[model samples]
Target: MFRKLIEDASTWHWWREWMLIFLGCIMMGTAFVFFINPYKFVPGGVYGLGIVLHNIFPSIQVGTFGYMLDVPLMIVALLVFGGQFGARTVAAALFTPGYMNLLTRAVYPNEAAVESLDPALLLNGQLNLSDDLLLTAIMGAVIIGVGQGIVVRQQATTGGTDIVAMLLQKFAGIKFSTGILLADGAVVLAGLLVIGFGLGTGEAGEKGWVLTLYSLITIFTTSRVIAYVLDGASYDKLLFINSDHHDELRRFIIEDLDRSATYIKARGMYTGNEREMIFLVISRKEVRQVQHKIKEIDPRAFLVVTDAYDTFGEGFKPFPSADVMQAE
Candidate 1:
C-alpha cells in the first residue's frame, strides 16, 4: 500500500495537480499578504480567524496561526473523513500559510510593523487602501475568490471551516452551502466583536458595524467568484426550434456546427398541430450563430433558448462535478 501510494504520488498527473495547487497557493498568499492581513480583513476561514487572533496576540503573525490551525485540522479531517480527498489538499493547506508568512515577512520588517497597521509599512504603502476600505474589500474579494476557486477545482479544499461544512453535510444533513455560510458567518461575527469592538486589543472603535458590512461584501463576492470559476463564465444554451426549415437547421447544426440535435414529436396546445421539435444543446457562443441561421432559413421560425446548467456527452464535459464527486 505504501509503495502504491508513493508511485501514485510521482505521476505526471500528480505533478500537474501540484502545479495548479502551487499557482492557487500563490494567488491566495498574495491576497493575504498584500490585501487582507495588512488591513485586518476577516473574510472567514482559518486565515480570517488568524487575523482576529493576530490582533489579540500582536507578537504572533497571522500566518503562524494558520499553521497552528491547519496542521491539526488536516490531521482531524484525514482521520474523520479518510483519504478520498487526496494529498493535494494537505499540500494546499500547508503551503498557503508558508507562502503567506514568507510574503508578510518580506513586506513587514518585523512583527511590530504588522501590529502597528501602518500603511506606510504595509506593502510599502502601495496598497494602503484602508482609506478606501470598500474598494479594498472588493479587490481582496476578487483576488481571494479566484485563488480559492482554483484550489477548489482540483478536488481539494484548503481545510478550515470547509471541513466543518463537509462534516455538517455528512452528519447533520445540512446543505453544504448553508453549512459554509453558517461556519463563516460565525467567524465574521467573532471578528465584529473582537476586532471591531476592540475586545481583542482593547482599542475600541466605531468600525465594528462598518467592518461587519464590508466583511459581508467580501464574503459574497468571494463566493460568487469561486462559483464563476467552477461553473465557467456562461452556461450551455438549450435550444428548441420549431420552424418550417427544420431540415435545413438540422443540417446546419450537424454539418456546420459539428453538433447533434434530437427530434421530439409534439402538438401545439392552441393550434392543434403536430410538428417535430428540434432540441439541442450548444455552447453560449453558438447561440447567436444558431439564431442567425434560423432567421436566414425561415423568417418566422419559432425558436426558444434556455440556459443548460450542465451539458454532457460529445463536445462537452463527460460528467458534472457532482457526479464525479459521488463516484469518488
Candidate 2:
C-alpha cells in the first residue's frame, strides 16, 4: 500500500500537479477561514491589510478586495521580475481570492459565532492559561507554517506577500528571508494601527491592536516553523576531500555512509601537481559516520568542510528553523 501510494505520488502528470495545487489552495483557504478570519487576524501580506480594510467597511468582501489589491501587485511583479514569476503569482492571486470567496459564500449562512465573547477568559474562555495568548499564537503560527511548507513543496503559493517577497529578492537583490521579513513587517505594523492595543482596558480601539498583535505573532511563528520544516534539522556541512586513496574513500562513503560523492580535478598552486578532489554534502547526523569512514580509509586525506545554507534537490529538503518548528 505504501509503495503504491509512493508510486502514485511520483507520477509526473498534469493531474498530479493540479491535485497538489488544489490541496494547497484548500489548506490556505482553511487557514484564512478557520483561524485568520475567525480571529479577525491579519497575516503578513496584501491580503492581511485587505482584511483590515474590508473589516472597517462591512460592505466590502475580503475576497474581492484581496483580488483587486493583488492584481496591481501581480502586474508590477510581472513587469519587474519575469514571465515565469508573473505566471506563478497570477495563479496564486487568482486562486486565493477564488477559494476565499467560495469558502466565504459557503460558510456565510452557518455563522453562529464560532468564537464566543467573554471578558473574563480570553479566546472565548475555551483556551486555558496553558493555551494562553503565547500558546495560541504559536499553535496558529505553526498551522500556517505547515500549510505554507506544503504549498512550497508543491511549487505553488498563497500569493500576496509571497509575490512581494520574490519581486524584492529578484529586483532589489534582497535576500528572500530579509524580503519576507520586511513585507510581513509592514502588514503587521498596519495591523497594529488598525486593531489597536487589546491591553485589558477593552477600549473601543484597543481590541484591534490586540488582534493585530495576535496576527503578527502567528505569522512570525508560522514563518519560522515553515523554514525549519523545509530545511533539515541539522546544519549540513560540505566536505572536499583529497587523498591518494580517493577510490577507497569514495567506496567507503558510498557503501558505509550510503552517500554519493562527486570527483573533480584540482592542481596545487605552487607544487604544480594535479590531483582528484572528492566533494560531498552531508548532514550533521552523518558527519561522525563520514569522519570515521575517512579515518578508516585514509588518515592522510586532506579534508575541508564548510557549513552550507538551505540545500535543495536530491538527498535532502530544506529544514525549518526554531521559529518554523514552533509554528507547525
Q: Best by lDDT, which number?
A: 1
**What is the model-wide C-alpha lDDT for candidate 1?**
0.78
Candidate 2 steric clashes? 21
lDDT per residue, candidate 1, 1-328, as tens digits? 9998888877967778768877987998888787777667788889899988888887787878988988877887787666856476788888888888778877876778866656678766776777888888898889987877777677677878766766776678775445666788888988898888998578855667788788888887887777677666656999899987777987898899999889999999999999899999998888898888899999898989999866768788766644122111
TM-score of 1: 0.84
Per-residue CA lDDT of model 2 for 1-328, tens digit only, reads 9999887777756566556666666666666654566456777766677766654654556777788788877777678656854565577668877887676655544323322212123334343333265555566567767766565554445667766666675567674545666788887876666656422223336356677678767777766766665543558889998889977886787887788988899999899999889989988778787787778888987888888765666787644432221111
RMSD of each: 4.2, 7.7
Candidate 2: where is the Cα deviation over 4 Å? 1-12, 80-88, 108-135, 149-156, 197-210, 225-235, 238-281, 290-307, 310-328
**After aligning candidate 2 to the native by TM-score, how far in Å is the CA of 216 from where it should be?**
3.0
Q: Which residue pairs in candidate 1 collide?
A: none
Off by over 4 Å in 1: 1-10, 84-86, 166-179, 320-328
Q: Assess every candidate by TM-score.
A: 0.84, 0.64
User: In model 2, where is the ten-residue run with the lowest total lDDT?
Assistant: 111-120
The residue-level lDDT of candidate 1 at 199 comes to 85
